[model samples]
Target: MKKIWEFIATGFYSGKLPKMPGTWGSIVAAIFLYFFWPENIVYQLLIVAVTFVSSVVSSQSLSEQLDDKDPDSVVIDEIIGMEIAMLGIKATLPVVVAALVIFRIIDIMKPPPIKLFEKLPGGFGITVDDMFAGLYSNILLRLLIWRHYV
Candidate 1:
């Protein structure tokens, strides 16, 4: 039971990956999502929803366990944010590459309110900040797509 809770809290061990596991996890999840669903908006949105909720819950739980503030190891937030960034965008190689780079940059820089969100306590802070990052990335991606293709 304890182990199960830990696993769930840590994003099924994806959070435990060495180095920037969260980024890696997000990348993998995005790749898998693209391959599995391809151009399906429904599937992409579903993935975003699930990732958002799960990341919030998991980040909070993991923060409690670690007894530290927003440990880098717990990266479910990144995974969720990445999914949000990719939502509704075509899963083409160029788009995916652009989204990944943009999302990572925004996430790392933690601009404006995104940086502000980190002030919140525990998992809420961790997850919400990244969600905002994802949202920022999403908006930019949308504009880029619209400008170029639409």
Candidate 2:
């Protein structure tokens, strides 16, 4: 059971990579977006919903196993966040790349409410901040798409 949660929390070991595990997880997630992103907005939303619940459970479990507040190796949050960032948008090369960069910046900077989100205990705290970062990215990309900038 622990191993199963570990696998999920670590993004199937993408988080085990040396240095910048979050970045690595996001990269893999971007690739996942490219290959697996749904065409319908409704389905895209469903995927995000499922990912959100699973990521929360897996991340929380792994955090308990490791006895850490936010384990460095748990990157499922980043993966799901990236998925959310790409929601309802066309998965073009430029869009995917932009989502990746924007999500990472917001995630790292942890601005405003995102910073506040980090205060929650357990996996909710660990994952919610990235969810906000992804929301920001999603909004920016949606605007750019609407304006024909992206």
Error at 40, model 2, angstroms? 0.8
Name the candidate that leads on TM-score: 2
**Regions more than 4 Å wrong, model 2:** none
Which pairs of residues have clashing backbones in candidate 2? Answer: none
Listed in order, each prediction's TM-score against the native is 0.81, 0.95
lDDT of 1: 0.75
Model-by-model lDDT, in order?
Answer: 0.75, 0.91
Report clashes for each candidate as comma-separated counts.
0, 0
lDDT of 2 at 27: 97
Q: Write the per-residue lDDT of candidate 2 for residues 21-107, one digit (tens) a residue.
A: 999999999999988888899999898888888888999999999899999999999998999899888799889998999899989
Poorest 10 consecutive residues by lDDT, candidate 2? 141-150
